[model samples]
Target: MDQFILTFLKNASEKNFQQLTGRFLPHYFTLISKVGGMISPETLTSIQKALQEGRLADIVSKIQEVITAAENAVLEVAVIGESGTGKSSFINALRGLSHTAEEAADVGVVETTMHKTPYQHPKYPKVTFWDLPGTGTPNFLPDTYLDKVGFEYYDFFIIISSSRFTLNDARLAQKIKDSGKKFYFVRTKVDSDLYNEEKTKPTTFKEDRVLQQIRDYCLANLSDIGVSEPRIFLISNFDLDRFDFPKLEETLLKEVPCHKRHMFALLLPNISDASIEIKRSFLQEKIWLEALRSAALAFIPCMTFLMGFDLPQQEQCLKGYRSYFGLDDKSIEEIAEKLDTPVQDIKGHLKCLDFWSLVKDDSIVAKSINCVEAFCAVNGGPSSSVVQGFKAYILRSKFLNVVADDAKHLLREIETVNIA
Candidate 1:
């Protein structure tokens, strides 16, 4: 938890450095970095001897190289919808920005976003949200939208709408589908209407059923447009928790392919344990590859240094890696603001799995940790009797993975074959 440790971890993660230095390197380097400015010449000389003799130099060098690559990596997402479906607001929400007219501008809803308006998420600018004008303007043809937006550039499409789907929305969706890209239907602004309906509820018993009814309504509407068994997400850009934003995310995660989904998880507004796990897994995938490649690069047969540092670094680098992958505080708050799910509920979802326990300090230490202790720490942790039920309903759910595979298959075809 020391500031330097945090800084070191952040820098290393951003750089994609995944070597484990072990009992010797972490403590030695951390101490050195802390005292490097004031250390005596003799002391510095001794440390250098230890580093060279112990063979830490090569490990450090490789770590630096991979870290730099991760920092330079860019993942871009394309936002598509007919004009005025709150694409801009959705982008702002995803990026953790306020909803001022100038800040979250869409085409018909505000001033038309003349070209592709790129919005950077506050946390990761390397990942972008590109907002294109509605493909459904009065005289605009469906193909024109694809031409203007350059459909091939985006990793995926986020189709947005505040109300009913229009011809433009359908056209764009079809194009994306035909082109073999992934798209999600985001129903924004459910908070205002839901709240109004709650205010005028005829019976308290009907509240739960009301939500289900709304979902059914949306699905039926999509079905009318030939979207068979349509899975529509009821979301509110203003209140994330209150609406079906979680379901929306689940849907998106399910449909997005693994290759890009990893990055998608990285860009998500981290709120729950599942989100944290998916994000960590995504980042870890890259680091794993980086580390593996670095080890391969150090394949010089006569290099004595490789023997001392390479193996240890590779084995231990993933230690404390999990903490680096979870949603940071800002992302969680942004998600909380939009979902209207009490930040506590989001925290509660994570806390349920002894997430804090599994996450040692701020880093991912192991694949799995004892959640029982975390549960005990938090008021006996969901009575032992219900643990199985909890896992079945929540933690172990395979819903997200199922959707991701479907989307991944779709994208593989598109990415491999260029459709004119």
Candidate 2:
């Protein structure tokens, strides 16, 4: 793909540019992002015109604006449910924190969550989860629920239940919807449900059948409170890879406004292969702009780490890859504890790290792109910005893929029969 992109850039004919623009036509129905932060026909045309008019400064300013806004974007998620519905546990799991982790939310008995408590993802503090007091709590009048919980402060609400949806849950949903907000209904502790079914009816047990029954029950319960076409995600906070957790995460990504999606996607813990791919694609989208910025820099995060770039900065970039992909030492320890598996067992899955020396100092990537200089410059001499940006992009792209693949491998390794 890098070779093809470089080749296309070297000889960008009208036909090729048209094809490129066609590929990036704006996606209006879903997320929106800064002009050059993502691919769209407008971005392509703007860049083309800028190059033709020699307005490099204008393009650079736009890139800076987009990257800055993306870095500062914030998302506030609220998780609300009756006490013991596993609300705190769900927040812990979502943040990829183990129960024993100091930052984890406090687990409760029947009605323990007394107020709206905020929990931040250890790595991405900007993405916060509020463990909201349940609407069913006896202390609050039903009509005053939304105001009392500061509903307007939340970007989205997740209403969870261990068994079935309750009247209070429905009321909260209605209020959120009427007030112009989004909410999701999650049925937690599904691992227990499946285990019970398997244990008691081993002879007749079918995972699909059992899951359908639970879904049917939740649908019926929510419908009773006037929820139309309720979409209830069945999940076990302890085992997010199974059941509808992936679906829930994907749905949220689609619904989150385009500007905030980058942070939201980056902060997702590696739960499934699908999620790893999502992060990869999101990162992949920025490579072109980042490369441009890097070339401009001599400039620029994903745009970090030049072949002769600063070593300390390179180390920090590698640490970021490890942490973002959930392979950092701390995250690995937490994952091992969560799965009740030996830390070595988790590390064993990352066999790629043993034989893949190029990942450390991929001079080969630099060699493959002998044309990087040619592609970056056209007027006369090779532009340092173009050369540095190309090198930065290829190097960053390689590491991103490597980290994502390792994450998928580690997730699969830990999710064996022992996890339940």
RMSD after CA superposition, every candidate? 18.0, 4.9
> Per-model C-alpha lDDT, please?
0.50, 0.71
For candidate 2, the TM-score is 0.83
lDDT of 2 by residue, 379-407 (tens): 34555545544555666677677778888
Highest-TM-score candidate: 2
Model 1: CA > 4 A from native = 1-74, 100-115, 202-205, 254-257, 283-300, 303-420
Q: What is the number of residue pairs that collide in model 2?
A: 3
Task: Write down the lDDT that model 2 would get.
Answer: 0.71
Per-residue lDDT for 111-226 in model 1, tens only? 47656788766556677889886666665678767766788777678777767776677777788888888777777777766677878874563656766777776677777776
